[model samples]
Target chain A: MKIVAIDRQGKEHTLEGRDGWTVMEILRDGGLDIAAECGGACACATCHVYVNDGWFEKLPAPSESEIDMLDMALAVEPNSRLSCQIVCSETTDGIKVTVAPE
Target chain B: MTAAAPIETDVAIIGAGPIGLFAVFELGLLDLKCHLVDILDRPGGQCTELYPEKPIYDIPGLPIVTGQELTNRLLEQVKPFNPQFHFNEMATGLEKLADGRWKLSTDAGTTLIVPVVVIAGGAGSFVPKRPPIPGIEVFENAGDGVGVHYAVRKMENFRGKNILIAGGGDSALDWTINLAPLAKSLTLVHHRDGFRAAQHSVNQMRELEAAGKIKFHVASVKALHGEAGKLASVTLAGADKSEWHHETDAFLPFFGLTIKLGPIAEFGIHLNENLIPVDTAKFESQTLGIFAIGDINTYPGKLKLILSGFHEAALMSQAAFHIVRPNEKLRFQYTTSSSSLQKKLGVS
Candidate 1:
């Protein structure tokens, strides 16, 4: 799948991912500065991001732990999602997410 | 060749938490002596104090274990050398003696002389800040603070219990989502209807509420009600001065910790709030012979993680060892040499 990650500096990177890979893993492997403090256990909300419009429905719902983590995140929005909670799938092949201002 | 017995050991560690415990293991393997000290009655720092009952899934080599259990395993892992330990005494300050040895003062009025000091305090030493609301102190006397908590590690504590959560941040929202399933009833209160959490988390909370799993309150907690020294209900007031009461078994507030620069600040250590500025390569603070590890130290691209802290501790300890013993041979040895010595004594 093709995913585009826009950082806080507005620099965009188009990365490739396998089906079922979380956005967090893709960014981390790409050496982006997304802080996944809890290592994607959904225990800490350090990997939050804003998904582009119309992409929210394509992603799966977050777990309870992910919600708890996001509660402590900064600059949260309607489209905020823990990147670790967003799984890549056929319908989400061209997902666009921007790292939130931490 | 026999090792020379110097006037002092290599490093002195403050705070025997996970990071400190790991420092001992790393330093011991490097054939250095570490004197570990803590103000707590026992070791393990925050893991033993705050979340001892909470299960930790992150640490390697153990699929899952309680915080207290992890502390025990860490203690066991570093038990062979019998590293010097001092407990129940807080480190008050550090003084540079005329002889070049560092003098550390404790709250108990004891002074310790060491060459180097490593601070590995996790989010343990700092306390969570209580929300500043008018008449909030009234709840403190009625044991409302007892049921109201800041950190959520064990779901059992809130399981089958009616819970009310406050805040729109990630921590507050995360707990609301996690506890919705286990709690008999869950109520989430945020200052604004819009959340500052992950979009997916907010979506999940909305889904749970729609499915009759939880309730949301877009207001701030105004007052806490109690009778006979236990929480009875919480009163929330909206922006329009409307108030509502909801009976709850417990109140879980996920507001983040209010961190301040502690004792290290007195020594002229340069810092921004609780974070210490450092050279990413050396991990050295503004003061010589002093190093800050874990979340306390900040750099250009530093990501605070337990694993990253482990790496920081390893790097800092090696540099500390070198500072104390400039000419000493630096070797990479996995197992501590003391273990072999103990095996020879049949103590293993």
Candidate 2:
């Protein structure tokens, strides 16, 4: 699957994501500077990003715990999501997200 | 010191984790003064608190070592430096002072001014997990009133007050045992009979309960009764039919520990994701006079292993010396080969 991550400076990163790897892993492997702290535990909000508008509704709703951590994320938006929660798949190809500021 | 006055040092390290501890040795060898601030009340971060008894296999030459033992060795290794520590505090505010030095403050209101700042926080600061109940903060926001409390900032504040503590963790059980004699009345409430705290603490809590020194209830906080920001009464809903109102002046909930980037998230330094992005050469952040190491930082081909952080700390110190002592020429020497380095360690 392919995904795009736009950094704070507007640098676009196109990444090849393996099926089992998360969007965070793909972004990190592409050297796009995603924290992914606590790895994929979903405990930390450092992996926060804003999903593109039309794609936001296509994804599953954020879990309660993820929502709780998202509340602590900086510059949270309605489309905000944790990249750790977004595992890569064929359905998620072409997913576009903007990395949230720390 | 209060917020108005700042503590002066050559370096201010943001964490007291393992990597942060090692940085003290590197910076100390360069004759730079250092002060470390951490959210944990003690050193060793996760190693000491989370898995003190767990055996770690990957710490270099040691065949195997307990987490606490490893932490102890590191602390002993850095003892000669006489590094000062400010525990139970999070680095909150960061800025560049007028004279090109950095000014940083903690959640405890302690301020630090230094030419170089090192961030070694592992996954940022540890934040306590709060109960999911709504309106709990309203009482917590009441400013040390009856309804809610998270941190026991001042033990004296609860003296002679009726206190209710809820949780099955170590903190809840320990506080129940500690405050039973001091409080006018103390109650330990949990959702179930089983607890995850130390067996001794659980036994002591039970002993106090049996002796009538403290009350124990197997129930959950269903609702709160308080007005004007003060907690008055708490309703406990038991598994049985009875829902009872327990009168209390203060409520302390100790759910567990969770990590958050905390105030570090607000610093003006550009973050690659939630991490401090640093140059591989010096591990310095994009901001001048500030360097980041350990798991809290990210760079190209970065590895988060503890040994990698140790490597980053060494490089960070050489760069830090340039900022702390601009006029002095750096003399790089190995502890294994240099008598000066061995003498600094008191190890020859």
Candidate 3:
């Protein structure tokens, strides 16, 4: 699977996503500047991302814990989701997301 | 301030994370006493600090364990070792003594001398998150009561000053309530109306705002207008993109904490990308008698995991024992079979 990430500078990078791996892991492994401080544990909201409009509905809804973490994140939008909570698979192929600011 | 007397121990561990906790057990097995220093007030490093309730599945033997649970278990396992812990302190300065010992100092003025120094600092120290505003750096550490501060070192410094507190967390709300009585003017600014802090604190802050003791604004700090390291005013951006300037002599932003390789960088050790380079065998740094493990250390095939740090602690203690007790011959024993090891664990 593949994931497209937009960095803070508005630069787009295509990352190879592994099945069952978190979006945060994929972005970090692909050399994207996602902090992922909790290492995909969904504890820290440093891996926050704004899911693209079309792709927001493609992934599963965030859990209550994920929503709680998002609430702690800065600049939270309706589409704001913790990338660490989003697992990549066939259904999430070609997912697009924009990384949130620090 | 006069420094306190130095504490002498067999090994001085820089962090109280999982790896450092386990190092106590390994070193204790060989009868090497340890003293650990951590920046956080408690143990578990990122585990307890970042995600205590988060479940970790990679720990061996156990299918799953929470971060706090793992820390509690490690604390229990090392209880018999009686490893001294100096919390709420960061290992700031490192120096080699003429007696072939290392002297470690902390921001809290704590000093420790040991033959071996183990750096289990995972991602370094947890420090306050700074607001990502341009030109904010100039306003930091501005002495004589004018600058941006993440923490309140002295309440007198903020007293009678126009202070602006940011974030809706406990620190901001608590400081708002405490400083409002003393400030000439106080403003609490946040991005949203809702707060992530305790309901009691939020209610208290609301009461203060209702009483007109403090100004509450649902806005984010956009820019800091300051000159010569002195903050004069801050530009705040509202939800509707409305911008306005607010006068303030001090800015306190408590957006929670994020870890960084802080004072560890100045320890005179060789660093690669802010991570200490260590050998895969002993996990020792370039400087003899000093070792780095866990996420803070980089080596061939190094993996940043709790389990990996556990293994590294085991090997590191073996090398640390040689340095701490060079005259004594090393004995390899397992906790599963050795009665002496069991005795050290207090099971026998």
Candidate 4:
């Protein structure tokens, strides 16, 4: 599977994805600026991202804990989701997301 | 220069995280007095700050332990050592003294002089997350309560002013409820209508909103408008994508904190991609009398797990002892069988 991430500078990079890995792991491994400070524990919302409108519904809905964590994030929107909670899979191929501001 | 006298100790540890706390036990067994400095108000570092209630199953002896419980246990274990802790301070400066002792300085103006410095800073210090607003720095620290403020130091400073609080967490809701009565007008802006705060606080805020004592809006502050370090108003991006301006003398955003390497990067120690490189055998950094452990240190086959940090702390303490007591012969003894060691732990 493949993942596409847009940098804060508006540059897009195509990254390889692995099953069972989160989009956050892919972004960090792909040399993006994703902090992922909690190491995918979903305790911090630093891995926040805005999914492309087309890809928003394709990903699973955020859990209550994720939503609670998002309350601490800045500039949260209707499409904002914690990238660490979105696991990469065959169904999630070609997922596109924009890195949220710090 | 700090006007206060420098605190003298055998060893100075930078962080009070799990590893730093455990290092106290190991160093205390060797009769080394330690002083720890941490940015957070409490111990446990990220464990307490980020996820105090989260459970971990990997701690060796305990089957499962929450972050806060592990911190409590570590505190109890190190109580006999009487290691001093400087909380709510960030270690910002490091210099080698003429006497070969290291002098460490904090943003809080406290200083420490020690023979050995151990950096158990796990992933660095947790700092308040700044909103990505342009020119926001000009409005920050603007005479206490007239401009942008991250934390409310004194509620009275905000009294009788037009106040705007942002965030959906407890800090925002609690401040809104408390400051509404004091402010000439109080407005709370959040990205969504739902709040993550306690139900009681949220209900109280809603009651205030209903009584027209406060205004609640489901919007995000997109841009700040101010002049001469005084905030005049803020541009709000409504949930419907429409924008509007709201007047406020003070703006407070309660975005949660994120970790940063912070001033440790300027401590003259070499860093490998923001992590201090240390020898696996001694866990000592390139600088003599300086050591790095936990997630802040990088070595071949290094693991950032708390268990790995505990092992590193043991090895680091041994090297620290040599620096603290150069003329004393090192003696290794098991705590279970060594009377001297047990005495230090107050278990004999």
Report fnat for all candidates as fractions from 0 to 1.
Answer: 0.23, 0.00, 0.23, 0.70
lDDT of each: 0.72, 0.83, 0.88, 0.92
lDDT of 4 at B262: 98
Evaluate residue B338 in candidate 3 and report its C-alpha lDDT on the 0 to 100 scale. Answer: 97
Regions more than 4 Å wrong, model 4 = none
TM-score for the second chain in candidate 1? 0.57
DockQ for each model? 0.17, 0.05, 0.39, 0.79
Provide the TM-score of chain A alone for each candidate, in the order shown: 0.92, 0.94, 0.96, 0.97
lDDT of 3 by residue, B105-190 (tens): 99888899999999999988888877668878999998744689989978888878999988877788889988999899999988
- Which is superior by TM-score, 1 or 4? 4
Residue-level lDDT tens digits of model 4 in B1-348: 455788999999999989999999889888999999999999999889888899989999999999899999999999999999999999999999999999999988889999999999998889877888788888998986689888888999998999999999998999999889999999999998999999999999999999999999999888888767778989998989999989999998988798999999998899999999999989999999999989999998988899999999999888888888889999999988999888888887
Error of 3 at B235 (Å): 0.7
lDDT of 2 by residue, B1-348 (tens): 457578999999999888999999899999888999999988988677556776777778987987688889999989999999999888989998789998899878999999999999888777776665667777876765356887787777788999999877678888888888889999888756767667899899989988999998877777788887788988887757378999999988876566778888888988976899999999999999889999989998998787899999999999999988999999999889999889889988
| Candidates sorted on TM-score, descending | 4, 3, 2, 1
Give the range of the ten consecutive residues with the poorest summed lDDT in model 4 chain A: A53-62
Q: How big is the RMSD of model 3?
A: 2.6
On a 0 to 1 TM-score scale, where does candidate 2 land against the true structure? Answer: 0.73
Q: In model 4, what is chain B's TM-score? A: 0.97
